[model samples]
Target: MAVLKPLGDAEMDERQRRMMDAMLVRGRDYNVFRTMLHHPAAMEAFLGWGSYILSDQNTLSVALRELAILRTGALRRCEYEFLRHAVIARQHGFTDEVLHAIAVGDRTPLTDEMAMVMKAVDELVVEGRIAPDTFERIRSTFGDHTAIDIVWTVGQYSQVCMFLLTAGVEPDPDVADDPLRPLFA
Candidate 1:
């Protein structure tokens, strides 16, 4: 159960309904977004930043970005984030085997680029900073701007997982049985 109950469509004010409608165009009324509607102002700001993070403006490939996000969710044990992003991750070409490997901290068979990104996520999640060698690798492969974006991606998703866990947010009913569930468990 969520610590804060999600507001249903009927329960929303006009502004909140519009926001929910806009979000629905992209997907369903995810419980996290619905719960966020309880505070309209904060939800507005969150939507903007969240949009940019998932957009092409972030410089990282969608695959890399989702990889970092999945790792963060697994590390934090945030089922909502892990399950939700797992769907998107699959759309972006992450196979089930790769997703499971990420959840369990296995990096074998991944491309050098992906392995480095996973290593960076691990270092950031566990140590709060990327080691120098990892930092150099990221910078060299993707450049300084992307290096920053990678870190930002990891940090942003880390915060998201923490919020979902702390709020006790529930996964959407449809995704509750996501295959990734047991990995997190």
Candidate 2:
């Protein structure tokens, strides 16, 4: 069960209702936001930084950003986070082959440069810093700004993953597909 249950419409105060109405995920209030509405001020603060990483301001292509997010979520074993990003990734043209590779540690599904990027996310998650060689390669390819964006992207999603897992947030109904894993149970 969720540590803090997501508030239903009736449970929300006017302020939370307004926040919920404004903070749509996939066009509806996701459980993450519903749960987060318990502290609207904090959620509002999270939104600004989250929006930047997710917006065009970050300078990483949507595809590259999603790649970093998917890796961080998977490495963290954050089912909620990984599944949601899986939806975004597919919407942006990530193949099932690539998604499965991320879920299961297979690199064959990615391009060489893309695989290197994922490796950086993996190191960042597991080691808290990308190794010097990986850092140099990414800096050379993506430039200083984008290289930092990759770190920021991973950091953002990883924090979200921790929140989801720690709070025991459930997956939204709209984000239920999981070609990234499993078949008939």
Best by TM-score: 1
Residue 71 CA error for candidate 1 (Å)? 0.4
- Candidate 2, residues 1-185, lDDT tens digits: the string is 69988989999999998888886644857899998888889989998999999999997889889989988888888877778888889999988888888876678879887888889998999999989999999999989898899899999998898888889888787766665545111
Worst 10 residues of 1 by lDDT: 159-168
C-alpha displacement of 79 in model 1, angstroms?
Answer: 0.7
Give the clash count for model 1.
0
Q: Which whole-number lDDT from 0 to 100 does residue 179 have in model 2?
A: 57
TM-score of candidate 1 relative to the true fold? 0.95
lDDT of 1 at 108: 98
Would you estimate the TM-scores of all the predictions? 0.95, 0.93
